[model samples]
Target: MITTFPIVALFILLGLAIPVGLVMALVGMAGLHSIGGWDMVSGIVQSTPLSTAGSYELLTLPMFLLMAEFVLISGVADDLFRAGAAWTGRVRGGLGMATALAGAGFGAICGTSTAAAATLSATTLPAMIKQGYRPDVAAGVVAISGTLSMLIPPSVALIIYGLIAEVNIGKLLVAGIVPAMIVTFTIIATIYVLVLRDPSVAPAGPAVPWAEKFRLLKVTGPVLLLFAFVTGTIYSGIATPTEASALGALAGFGLALSSGKLNLGTFRKALVRATYGTCMIMLIILGATIFGYYFALTQITQDLIIWVQGLGISPWIVMVMIVAFYLVLGCFMDQTAILILTVPVIVPLVVALGFDPIWFGVVMIVTAEVGLLTPPVGLNCFVVSRYSGIPLSEVFKGVLPHILAHLLALALIVGIPEITLWLPSHMN
Candidate 1:
């Protein structure tokens, strides 16, 4: 009955369109007060926010967000898309492939999917449309491609997952590299197949001169070097994830400065945006921590795990059910909110089933990526539609195929845990 109240209240508050952090905090405090009166609630209210905000691991969030903001101001997204188009534009559906490639590259630097989607929509979507690509195809490609940021290194989602699940943030970030690459390729393949089926969807462009292609490629070097430096240092154990994030932020600022795109005003904007993003995530973490305390007090995770074990079903079936739950929940909730609300309950249950938390983190992210493209609250789709002037229906129409691509990638990761675990295991 105690657990039932909080869960029901959570749903009711969420349905009321309340901010996730406040909703969780209110329900949690109320639940705690119910369990142990105002004394417990007072103690929790005093300690939880400070502890959550003060985490060293949490520093990674703002640094990476700052890095991404600076990179956004740097005009790197435009360069990435142009460079990609130059190389791939002559092939059938080449521009769409270029969008995926550019999206992946931008995602390497920009950790947020909405930013990636908006950037691509502004840069690549127009180009694809002007090139006579089908609007739905173009919009779908842009929307789904943005999801790469959710799985790529320096991913904010994965970082938050690591913190909540109590896994190594460095290894968690490293584990995403291969899965991200596979997803990028899968998206590119999906585009190819789409064009193959209907050549009119993405008509090939005139070939780029070899010289011009090489010149365009040169512009991508710095971005690539920055990504390599950040991920490499972490993989080589030369820097902790937090150290790498600071270094990456420094590099991003340098790039923005060198490009002459970041002025005093832009610099201020970056800091403010980073600060705002950090505060938002911190609040979510704080509320989640409070709620997590209430949840732990209820002893529900242990009971749920025991009940599942006694069900006499295959663990894989249970895993599928969990994934389905995420997929459905994702349709209506923000990805970060989903992670904050569920990781505490799910991670322990997963570990009890003998699943790797690291691998499961990757799977969780991939599912979240899918959610970002699904309807009703497909954030990336809405971003694409808002930026590109595509109808909401068309944006959703376009993402259907890429959603399948995401599923295919998810299946591969789920079936072969090694795909996610291999690189992290070998990390120095």
Candidate 2:
């Protein structure tokens, strides 16, 4: 029987003001000592960080971050948003749709929600508002849409979940392709429907000259080429994700140079930010590694799985319960923090119930994405609010409609695991 003391210790420490990584490591150290003695405790603590630091699959994390930083500093996203605006400009709610589409594209490459929200908000919201998109709709769409990155491949969340769950990261990355498309379209449709419901939310924009629309692609060419190459290589089985990320980083650097955004100062800034991002993520991994070992020592997951199995409920019921738990957890915690703390417990239960980890990763992420638009701690909302100069309440109010769309997308994936599994199943 797992004692309440360890679990209590975990919660109590988490509730305190300590950094998340430190809290996990501290509880893990205490748990390790009790279950396996000083030698085992010290041995695991000493070894986990080394193995985590040395991980080969882990190389992709930093490389992807570098790629995003390069793209950000180079203004690649500016062209993307521009093209999206031109193409969708004349349609009702089209600017918002363009923002959503550009958000998906950015998220696919960057995989960081706060950065995406801030960057895309700055890029798109001002124009959307000037174009007569309601202040709420303009900021809300960018804020919520930016979270699409958390769902799409090259995603940090999926990578972490794959690592913790011991699933194939490549397949996990690949699995997100179809579901992302589904979500992207849903987001667009949600925007369109809201505008349809109340035309004041977003007015129809004047048509772009076809010539001008195509002309905008001039600035967008390098980014389009890079995006195609990077995503294509991964989907085509031509490169491991890490290798593709390296290529993408190179492509981003080249684009940065071509765009006139490259400089010693800019390069250094991107590199430093990537380093900081990589270190923070690595710490979380190490902490989770220690915490996973601690949970194993206490048999918490194993015992919980057995007890839940004894209930004789349907597997899908348990899966829904897990999703609900994540939804609740997400409201109060950072997505990364939730991943480190819950994946160990949740993955085992999910596997024991015969669910695919990759599919569950998609579901987990979509649920978490909803949290990013929700209240009390919606980081993305705050990022958008700060950048757009909108109140947080207005931003949240705007995101509510799209949040429904996100929930619909979640239901679609949950109802059809094939949505997430089909692409991965065919991966070369």
Query: Estimated TM-score per prediction?
Result: 0.99, 0.97
Model 1: lowest-lDDT 10 consecutive positions: 221-230
lDDT of 1 at 215: 91
Per-residue lDDT for 1-428 in model 1, tens only? 88898899999999988999999999999999989999999999998888888888888999999999999999999999999999999998999999999999998998999989998999999999999998999999999999999989889999999999999999999999999999999999999999889899999988999999999998899788889768989999999999999999999999999999888899999999999999888888889999999999989899999999999999999999999999999999989889999999999999999999999999999999999988798999999989999999999998899998789889999999999999999999
RMSD for all candidates, in order, please: 0.8, 1.5
Cα error, residue 374 of model 2, in Å, equals 1.1
Candidates' C-alpha lDDT: 0.93, 0.85
Score residue 108 of candidate 2 by CA lDDT: 67
Task: Give the candidate number with the greatest lDDT.
Answer: 1
Q: What is the lDDT of residue 416 in candidate 2?
A: 89
Off by over 4 Å in 1: none
Query: Which ranges of candidate 2 are over 4 A from the true structure?
Result: none
**Candidate 2 residue 373 C-alpha distance from true site, Å:** 1.1
